[model samples]
Target: MSEFEWLKRAHAYDEADAEDLEGRVIAALRTVYDPEIPVNIYDLGLVYALDLDEDAGRVDLRMTLTAPGCPVAQTFPGTVEEAVRSVRGVDDVHVELVWEPPWSRDRMSDAARLQLGML
Candidate 1:
């Protein structure tokens, strides 16, 4: 094969690997629960975005809490970072707390809503 074809294959492999890594990272996030809520962070819809840099083995998570004055506000971000860092291939994790759109009950997953009896 030509060099360009080889590079294309390598890039495709990296993208697939990135996708798998993203699934693992999400699974890790699912293990983290909100101190006051019974639901895991992922199902709770607190996570706004998940970005992975496979080349650097870095994961960036953008999230928010149910409310601004949540009691675990100080520690929640750290908890998320720790969870993501525990993933097998994650070299670094950055958790950013955003409040731009704010969190609402409607943001939660249907399962989460059902669990809380909202549905």
Candidate 2:
């Protein structure tokens, strides 16, 4: 293959790898839950942003709690980081707690709403 074609193919492979890693990271996030809620964090829509660098095996996540005064606020980010770090390909995990948008029932996924009887 020409050099240009080879570069394109490599880029495609990298994208696919990144996507796969993102999926796994999301799955890991789903395994974490708020102590006060039965639903997973992912379904709760607390996870605002996920930046995964597959090549570096690093994941940067921005999330928020349902309430600022929620009891776990102090340690929740660490819990989230640990969960994400448990993923096979994740060598580094950083969890950032954000309250800018603030979490609300509206942020919850439909599934979460249904599970919580909000639907």
Candidate 3:
């Protein structure tokens, strides 16, 4: 599916199984950290979107790094893909790195801000 379609479908996860899997996927996402950041990518506002298809056992994720030139940019998506694929019910994972809209501190979670002393 197109990235926009995946993003639009992400909010339609209403099935109980889908919710459970989504939660697991989010938990899995929380385990991945930016090499230069102390906080996980999720809290750091790096994850732009997540679409999970329970029936297909697939996950489509959109994320970004702190900067386009970050050293791990080339390999970070693969790392995220591996993390999502490790979830029990997930059989396929596609991680897309997006620079459009660009990351800013405003996207960060309150907890992340507090942790980083930005709050």
On lDDT, the leading prediction is: 3
* TM-score per candidate, chains pooled: 0.82, 0.82, 0.83
Give the winner by lDDT: 2 or 3: 3
List pairs with backbone clashes in candidate 3: none
lDDT of each: 0.80, 0.80, 0.81
Superposition TM-score, candidate 1 onto the true structure? 0.82
Query: What's the lDDT for residue 47 in model 2?
Result: 96
- Model 3 lDDT vs. the true structure? 0.81
Model 2: number of clashes?
0
Q: List the residue pairs that clash in candidate 1.
A: none
* lDDT for each residue of candidate 3 in 29-97, tens digit (9 for 90 to 100): 776778998998999999999998999999999999999999999988987887777676889999999
User: Is 2 or 3 the stronger prediction by TM-score?
Assistant: 3
Residue 34 of model 3, lDDT score:
84
Distance (Å) between predicted and true CA of 6, model 1? 42
Name model 3 segments beyond 4 Å from true: 1-19
The digit string of per-residue lDDT tens for model 2 on 21-69 reads 8877776666677789999899999999999898999999999999998
* lDDT for residue 118 in candidate 3, whole number 0-100: 88
lDDT of 1 by residue, 28-106 (tens): 7776788889998899999999999978999999999999999888888987887677666789999999987999887
**Where's the lowest-lDDT run of ten residues in candidate 1?**
4-13
For candidate 2, what's the RMSD? 11.2
